[model samples]
Target: MYWWSAVGDYYWSYYRDACERSLLYLDVLRRRGEDYREQSAKAAPHVLSFDFVVLVDGRMLPRPVNYGLLRIIPPPEVETDPGKRPFIVFDPRAGHGPGIGGMKHDSEIGVALGAGHPCYFVGFLPQPVAGQTIEDVCRAEAYFVRFVADRHREADGKPALIGNCQAGWQILMMAAMEPELAGPILVAGTPLSYWAGVRGIYPMRYLGGLLGGGWLTWLMGDIGNGIFDGAWLISNFESNNPANTLWKKPYNVYANVDTEAKRFLDFEKWWGNPILLDAGEMRFIVDELFIGNRLAAAKIATHDGERIDLRKVKSPIIVFCSFGDDITPPQQALDWILDLYEDVDAIVANGQTIIYSLHQNIGHLGIFVSARVATKEHAEFVFNIDLVDVMPSGLYEIILTRADGAEANPQLISGDYIAKLEPRTLDDIRALGGNDAADERRFETAARVSEINRELYRAFLQPWVKALVDPAMAEFLRQLHPNRVMFRVFSDSNPLMAPVAKAAETIRGDRHPVEAVNPFLALEKMASTSIVVNLEIFAKAREAVTEAIFLDVYGSPLLQAVVGVGSSQPRAARASRGDIDLEAAHAQALADMTRGGFIEAGMRALLYVLASGGADERQFNALEALRNAVPEAARPPLSKIREIIRRQAELLRADETKAVAAIAEILPEDSGRRAEILSAIYRVVSGDGEPDAGEMEKFREISRLFLGKASPAELHDRQEA
Candidate 1:
């Protein structure tokens, strides 16, 4: 039956079409690659014109790394003073070469420039200098930041550093190491706590465990004959989404082969130009980051012996990660919070502020590259960065929503880029990490085994491996590598390419376009997504089973001891012991909270009436009435008023029922009014101490009672009245 079905009319036609399309895809890719090389060659002179500086090695390389800056708008260009803010866009140094950030005007850089902020980009060399380390890269980034900051300090606002993927963590490390260099750092799709993620679901994190260690990274560097090819890393990232990697990406090009040639070639030009990393650098990342998982743990040290403690960074950290990003899942992006601080109070006590916004479904690169993301998420972040700065030091989950009223677009837009700030507890974040300590301990033990294996492999096999490898073989191997296939096939050396390039030029001039939202195509994409999800689930289950067996066998105490368990020093030992010094920060926050004089006081009075009516209903109601009667500018200070509310809440906590009865006695109101007042008091007191689920629920219930339900007719009537 299966054999007959395979030969049947529908099956035969579908399989035949797929095969023919695949062949066509290969042909187009070849032509596109050829065209891309020619275009790049034509554009080479323009690229090299910018001033280039090389740090770390203190020497310039064969190719110049160039960048461009766009300044924020002028005062005449806008009605306002053009509140000058500096914007820095750091391009991710993944396998792909440079220019993803500023490839188009409708990019991260473009959005910042259009918003009337000065923009600068940090691009990289085609090849890293020999013996350069990540620490050196970080220092270079810090120097760039300092230069930007100096330029903007004479202006008004501070620079907002936007780091994409690899640059994200690098920028954060720079901030931590040199705390004064940058401000309002935004890490889009950057993973800080590399090991923090849900088990089974995030299988990418399992790669090290499955492979037994960082040996593969070592082996790859060895095979490359001392230079690790970044193409392999890019390949791993692409492989995670097999539908995109194996089918969708190539299939889309073939379906619209004639039209998609430019866009495909443009992306491939950047994607195909893989960078090289020193063997030492690759080993450091594999051991300290991917497997050792020591950055968040605060165990990572610089070559000079300076520890990179993420917590030491005093600036506000705004983490932007999405559900669709498999490479840097929200778990990896966010779990660092849990690793560093015991709770929200610890964050507050340390005088550090962190805010994170999670996107529903945007992929890793899309977080930084997508035009919609640049407009919506990136735009709002830039406009409201100061508001984030003023927020108290603690963890917050930024709730983004459309501002429906006139207050929207007070500065940047005609429409509201409205955002609500909601406080989140440590427990809320830890919920993302579904595993327990036992699970983490298993990995910790695995790290020990990894170190032992790596050490032994180096001692026994490295000598033999090094002797066998020659510079000629290494060059040949690199040229034949899968990622280099396009470059080799489409180079000027390829005999079949000259005619196709001319043909492509003619085809480019005569272009056809289609809407991205085509119904049939979207349906096909959706179906493909479902199949991908199912495959991912199957893959995860298979991995879990395999890991479980491996752990059961190798996780024994005897095996662990032989493999050198507890050999490495505890990660905590590296941390500098000191009490959290929030004295200066607290004073600053208090002063800011107290500003605005009487108007702030009135706002706080209003908050008190809103919060403590049940306990001190008469006093708060009278205060609110007095506040309403007074001139807006003459209202009492908000800071003092909040303090009063805290005092009242504390009193109510001492005796809830009696406090309500006393307030009722003081207030000259009807029984119904007293009940309403009591309910408001209960709500306020409930929410006063610490933010929690139960408190929020109680507050919501009471808010409804005091605010009351409004009918459409009633609202209109009030408006008319």
Candidate 2:
């Protein structure tokens, strides 16, 4: 009986091993069947470009849009004339493919085409075209813009360029290099100042430092036999959301596998086909951008030693980034404006127009890919690029909010698009990048440590590793990568479970789907949520420990002293185009200032109140009422208010010499009246903190030209005589 039991156990073990081998064999057959099916589908006439490319390039050669190796989808059957303003949509070459702009008809390109603008796409090949540097891509994109511009110049509006994500910075580089070739430039979710961010947030900027420097990129490129897989970058992005990466994303697809097949396939096709960057290119990005933070510092130099000054671009810049984007946070996107100029006035003074829009909560991918964002934000931006072009040269926040029915100045477009305006201040923008010196010092120290580690790694490990790697092995490894394997081996045909595939297809076709909003579905979602929560907890704990260790070692005051913080100030004032003459601006500014007499009078009134006693609400209300009821003639023009302030400053300048006599002259017959007048004048004159250079210059000139060499009392005495 004991011998019989032992034989049975052996038989069970053999049966299990045979079953696993059989399953593997069946998977290979099913994958071949799917490949055959895909090839058959490609040959079918119904599928456009065999479910590959949708747009046809109508150039002289009449090439396929897929010649660029990007899948381009054309708009619906709408007759858009080629004579209209052409729209060129450039997808940011981040870790993803090009279709984020036109994944659907409600995209940036689609919205432009819907508005009668002829649309074109600027995309890249899946593999780099041999020696294709970023400079070559910029040139190609510029040539594309030139083509569109020439096509639509007769229509009066220059072709508009919409750049998404990493494409935003690329477009700016193109625009800066060839300012005359393009029109409006819209940069969405691109970081110009790579190192700009506040503490407790935007910690992604610290990643290169914590992991060492660009040498890791070099190591990866070496392992890949001179090609750095973009999947690594995509993995870094996924690591930011561990719950989604580990469980939530896969579970959701599995739960709705029947309905999610097409969507999952389409997205996976793009996300899975990760591109490669050259070792040198990746090094430039990590060294010049990620660690050096040189772009905003005016320190990014070309191979020829020429500097790429962002201020040189003549076209208006529209910066669109969001708070929720960890990759390209609002700080990295907008702080470059602050870092490149002294103030909002300096931006205008440089003859450069920059407008930025900040969304409350949209992640990096959502900035250009999310359908809801495309409908609302991208729609408004397209409708108003012309308005934005005409806006006064200064920094502005582009706000998009719902308009009430009765609002008079609503700008309406096709189907539920309503947009309006609200002014924003520099203070509002400072919330993102306004970190103290100590925080910046910490990051600086991290950069130093990273440099040291990177050098050490290259000296010790790289030589031995490179000797063991080759191109064929790299390619094989890439194919075997988990992301690639999913596409290569999956779906319908297995001898062991051939029935399951047939069942799934039938279930998809004959779908008795429950309502998406069902209560039981919500319970299923709750169970999934628990799994996600636990994953998130583990990820957070890991991140916290990593950050703590990093900070403990590299965040010391001694390290900060050794590796200094980069200045967030502009190196020097950018040379202006002299479009706005300084004298003319001064006159205009004076004119605007003089028009606010009541504001001047209120300041005077404030001086009296503060000097006498702090005013109660009732007293303030009474003063406001009286101020509102004043006659129009009494209210000064901007010129008069400035003139009054000018004369008062002049009086103060003469205070050392003619203080008593001048005081006697402007003083009223009553001592109380004289005190009141002097106090009011002092408040207005000293509003911007004593006298500045321009104020002093203006005062000297005004005194010589207007009042001659006489005091107020002398002039009064002369009039009396």
Candidate 3:
């Protein structure tokens, strides 16, 4: 009976492993329940690694806001350089609590700290300050920036602002209002143009239209007694990916019970800690931003009667969006540029430098959370902050090339790589991708309908709902929400889960894990896959129905007329001011070309040539090194240097030949200085690799103007090099 004994051993191993896994899974749940209980007892809990003390509390403001600024104290291992530019990171307050930007070592704050920069975080309390408006929050953020700048007065520049998702728009608003307070601003996975998305491809944009718009939000807020439960927003996020929410997430933890528990629990801690918003604040965000699309159009006004115009922001803006991010697609992030400017010329004319980088396939959360992205994209952004700040006013596409010649894999980058900021045009953006006007019209109609519905609800339904509900009932509803119920049911407080801990302890002592080749384990995987597939099918069907209903209802000619959809085309472009005297500006640039000495002229020519071919991190680092090589007495202030570069770039753009020739006219006729300048230019251009034809030609032109034609020996040396 040897064959019978083998079969019996196989069955016993499989059965024992399965039972142990079940117990361990229950233990995971028990721990999760305990963690939830502990978290619930705290006010404004987060997962930040570093210690911090509050610098500015928004609650103490004249018009109180929930936001606060915390100065992160870098650990002993992480050195801080006070002379380096400081960084201020603002996490998204969409639905969850803060600290996503600094939750782990391979995160935004971590990268900044690694680079020896002082890091600060903008966090908020669990509850909003009563009657706090969006404008008040913006003011508080401005105050925070001013305080940070004051604290870092000895630093090279103002603090670089990093805004994640919802904080992106908030940061923009603050920058627009007080441009002097910001340095280079980086917005990750932020949607500035809410109505922008490719039809049929991204269906989340249609949800507001499908739900009859902002009235439902208003009703929910009223039911909550002037506080909107953030659980609803989190639920909406979960609904977008049902298979992940309902099957894959749970199955992943269950299938890898031993390893996945901590990860699942860590993420759930943030996911479960939903924050609240004032009713007015929620209404404004829904109506003005998502519905009216006012932010991009510069229609959003502050209490002091100043229109919040993004163009007013003097700092360079860096937008990081992903193609796979359904929540804030590339169109939503980049379309605001098209909305704000008529063309690339307008963007330059406004003296604004905008840089955008697109990740190929990172999801919404991955843009900010993925360790791979943190170490690569976010690190590059931080390292290149000064480069972006000094860049000439223009549109640029931040290109990250692979260091090892494979592909531009972010995970492969580990601080040693090449990053390029290539000049781009509005046409490049249009070619990249965006939604059409027809899609926008439907959203506009939804906005109008929402206004009508909001008025009707306030006039009728809201009063009755408010009179019926009290704070206790509202609290009960929040506690009974499906999102909360799931955590509560799996908690250790439940009598059914009492035996789980003891059973898990016993299983842990006698643990047995089945091999991957096991027949039962294979079956389990197949079952899990089938469950995910079925749930995905249902999700797709539901999305189809939702989109169909939205289109049919909002697309109706009768309803369109009622909402005044066709009254006039949406004001996509601002009226031409006809105020900028282009000829006068050109003349002024020409006159200013001869205003500097050899150092300035040489630097200008170098920048012009680099601009012609585009610049990457290598070129930037070489230039910085050259600048540092200059004698202290002769060195110009960095601000003055940037000003010179800006004026030189403008002149080159206006007339390249005149601008290049003017550099020779401006510099002294000293062959030694000229040779030194040419050598520096060669070094900068050839840092990454061989210079391209355009770069070579630009260099040759500069040389002809400054150092005459190269001799045969020089030409051969250049070719050989």
Top lDDT model: 3
- Backbone Cα, N, C clashes tallied per candidate: 11, 6, 0
Ranking by TM-score: 3, 1, 2
Candidate 2 lowest-lDDT run of ten: 43-52
Q: Against the unseen true structure, what C-alpha lDDT does each candidate score?
A: 0.62, 0.58, 0.84
> Candidate 1: misplaced stretches above 4 Å?
1-27, 35-83, 405-416, 470-472, 490-492, 496-558, 564-577, 581-721
List residue ranges in candidate 2 displaced over 4 A: 1-76, 81-83, 409-418, 421-423, 452-465, 489-500, 506-524, 561-721
lDDT of 2 by residue, 229-280 (tens): 7777777888888898788766755565544555655555456556666665
Q: What tens digits encode model 3's per-residue C-alpha lDDT throughout 1-721? A: 6977877777777788888887798788778777777877887788887899988888898888999999999998989999888999998999898899998889999999999999999999889988999889888999999999999888877899999999999999999999878899999999999888775666788888877789999999989999999989999999999999888988899889888989988888888778899989999999999888889888888987988888888899999999999899998899888888889888888888999999999999999999999999999888878788888898999998657655332332335566888889989888866666655667778889989988999999999999988999999888988877877778888999989888888877877898887776888889999999999889888878877887778777778788788735664656342346778888888787777777677777877767653667777777777787889777665666667778778888888877777887787888867767777777766766667777787778888877787532474365346
Which 10-residue window in model 1 sums to the lowest lDDT?
43-52
Write down the worst ten-residue block by lDDT for model 3.
Answer: 405-414
Comparing 1 with 2 on lDDT, the higher-scoring candidate is 1
Q: Could you tell me the lDDT of residue 665 within candidate 3?
A: 79
Candidate 3: residue 350 lDDT (0-100): 80
